[model samples]
Target: MNAHHDHTGPHGASPSGDALPTGTTGFTDEPQITLRGPAELADALPYTLGFHPTDSVVLLALHGERGRFGGRLRLGIPRSPREWAPVAEQLAECLVEGCERRGSRPDGIVVFLCQDPGEGESGRRVMERLRPFAQKLRTACGALDVPVYEALCLSGGRFWSYCCPDSDCCPPDGTALAPPGTSVMAAAAAYAGIHVRGSLRDMEARLRPRTARATVIGQERALDAASAALVHRILDTRARKDVRDDTIRLARMLVDRLAEHPPLADQDTSDTRDDALITHEEAAELIVGLQDRRTRDRAAEWMEGPEADHALRLWRALARRCVGAYGEHAAAPLTLAGWVAWSTADEPSARVALGLALEADPEYVFARLLHQACNEQLDPETLRECLRGEREARAQAGTRHAPGTRATARAAGARGVRRRLRARVGRSRGTAQGAPSTGPGSARPAEASGPGVGAHTGRRTGRQEPCGTRDGGPGGDPSGAGGADGSEEGSAR
Candidate 1:
């Protein structure tokens, strides 16, 4: 979710017009070269989205004079043709309104339908099949008062233009795409240090769960046992606070453990080796323990420097181990993974992990906030600064607790009292709150007295409640994301 709007001047032309490829000046005071044809536009797609899209509908907004490139949006193409109309409408309104909210009504839009042909399907058929969908898109945008100027169907190795009518230039059968890194845009991007990441699907594959039956079963069994053991440890009135401490400590230890092992040369082998290094028991414990939002937040402090990379690797491993009934449990680790990735400038992985996190639980506020901020391309430095500030505060607090300090003693005594008070209050609530008690021989308590209730206590009769929500907004992007608001969630303490 690179939602941060970036300002750059690039070449542009009207849908039916020839290239304005002369000396055009951009907002950056750089001479922006004009895009000549569909091939150049196709080449620009990856740079715009930061990755090549597959099975996607992408809209590029042309704004100000010279139709300079502005905001762009991409969404997966709806598989069902019947769904195309509404998808088109939604995409149109989202892009149009989003642009307006950002203070620019786009002059025109560049529509691209990117889908690879299925088995026995030709690129020509893909173009033909999606032609109506493209029209629907054009009509939707037009209705919103922003006409789509160049509607192109990109499939196979070529592109078909719906706006260009000349067979000599536009071609009915479509024109072949330029070889990779050979186009003029490629030269510009290279000179400018712009990187076109590989397809979004490839980035996401690293985070996807393993589907092998043996592996899934082993992980699920480990999860069940770990859940039984750790749930009790976490829920016990006497050891509740200890559990939170232990979870944080274990997460830090694992982060260190992951750091000791460098990544392998090959991605697959690296992933497999990393997965092997983490025992199912360890993975299950971390995955289940991290359900505690405070524990997860504590782990999030590891989101910079060498620690961040290891934390990311550990998170990816944990996510992989989220098999069977524990699938929903992946939200926490996956969100952490995304956050770390984004902080480290790995936008592709960040977006993929966050997307998976949301898919696991759409209501996960942290994921939603991170996803939106990422989509907007908000710089991560703002959040990093906040994290650093907190880290320094913690370090100062730690210094204050040196062994010979009387203040440390007093602070410890105060903390002990607070812990006891909280434990007592928690016990009282557990026994007398609205939650029902099964009374006799029930293995678990009826409902979570409040937050931090473990499912192992008893068979739950109601919908599972969110553990807690994240509080505080994502810090503003220094790159001018003043309008971007991070959605709030209750502090998952």
Candidate 2:
């Protein structure tokens, strides 16, 4: 999630002279709308988080007397209420400390608990069930001396406030949310060109692996064939470079192919067209070859312009192709998809993709770094500059070295590239003051690990060496690239 405050500017009162609600914030130079009560607060949740959260607990920090919005955090509501207390405590401290590091601790906090009812359960029952969870959140925030001014449970189209005791105003049966696009917050958001990107589940479904049995079988078979053909060459010292080059060549071709065909009006149809554009064999080759960090980093150079727009689509397509035992191979393409999304200012998708990348391989260094950076809201330009520099350095080395000695030069270039990238990453981490840790139970940057072998460990396909490494050649650079991938797995980890 993008933790940066959504609104930061001078405040204005509502036409009725009402104060802005605890959660709503103003956009600079845009028409400001005053959100009056729980109704407006509930309606503004989507705009604040950039999506309609489901099965999630959102905490928005408020600063000063007028309640200007500060940092925000969201986590999936724990299934077991037993876990709610600890989770609430962790979330409160994370958000509060984060705000402090950013310059001021929040003066107040607002909590939103959103979940749809299960089978045979009414919205009121849902609210009643989650009432204890809301109390836990309130107590957690209160423990830190930052009170939760309002706590709401939104379920099945109706909202109930834990902080309000007046049944006449809040209603014991719960009040229905305003019609979409009719709320004052919705109008102001639309005027500012801010759009809610649907529910988190919908955003994540786009990158998930194809689940149809036929598609899975076909894609898995293709992956097996590609692995058989390419793994040996990738492990061969002389052929590794060729494999990397071919991978880059194929990826660029696919990006161009996707760019040539504009997205169809319907997203599902557009995705289907994108899938059809690349043959199963082509996707398998690219997916298998991207295990090489250098190749994936080279492909990441297309992070802007028309190239990025199409590259994101292509990456998503490739991620969907990582099926069956090859599921873990998705870390590469998913990371690329996340990078492109973050670079293009699509934080929701980026977070989803990066989270999925970590799910694929928790030890993935590139995904971890990128995920942390995105969570911290670091300027994507810093990472972009690092990639551009690495590319330039390689180009210079290729020209400077003799043909017979270019391999040595390339190896040196790779080392230098890693150094520069790592330096930039370190600088970003240092500068991101008070940014919450990547996930719960951890407060440090993700640990770096060597590239993981393919997930099909039982098959014993030769020595399961990291990609880009050879028996007697330069080993794979443990520092891969700097970026993360995500999934909508109920948490941003």
Predicted model with the maximum TM-score: 2
lDDT for model 2, please. 0.68
**Residue 454's lDDT in candidate 1:** 9
Q: Relative to the true structure, how large is the alpha-carbon lDDT of every model?
A: 0.62, 0.68
Give residue 478's error in model 2 in angstroms: 1.2
Cα lDDT tens digits for candidate 2, 334-450: 888988998887776787787777667766767766766665555666556656755765677677865635445444444443444455445543222122343432222221110
For 1-493, candidate 1 gives per-residue lDDT tens digits of 0100111222224433334332211112244566655667776677655677777777777764555665566666666677678767767776666566445667777898888898999888999998998999999999988877678888898888887666776667778888889977677667766666677667666776778899999999998997887776654545655666787878888878778899997877899989988887788878888865545656777888888888899998898888888888888889999889877867656766876776676556667566655544445654555445444544655677665454344334232332332232222211111112122111111101110000011112222211112331222111211222211111221
Alpha carbon lDDT of residue 391, candidate 2? 71
Q: Among all windows of ten consecutive residues in candidate 2, which has the lowest summed lDDT?
A: 448-457
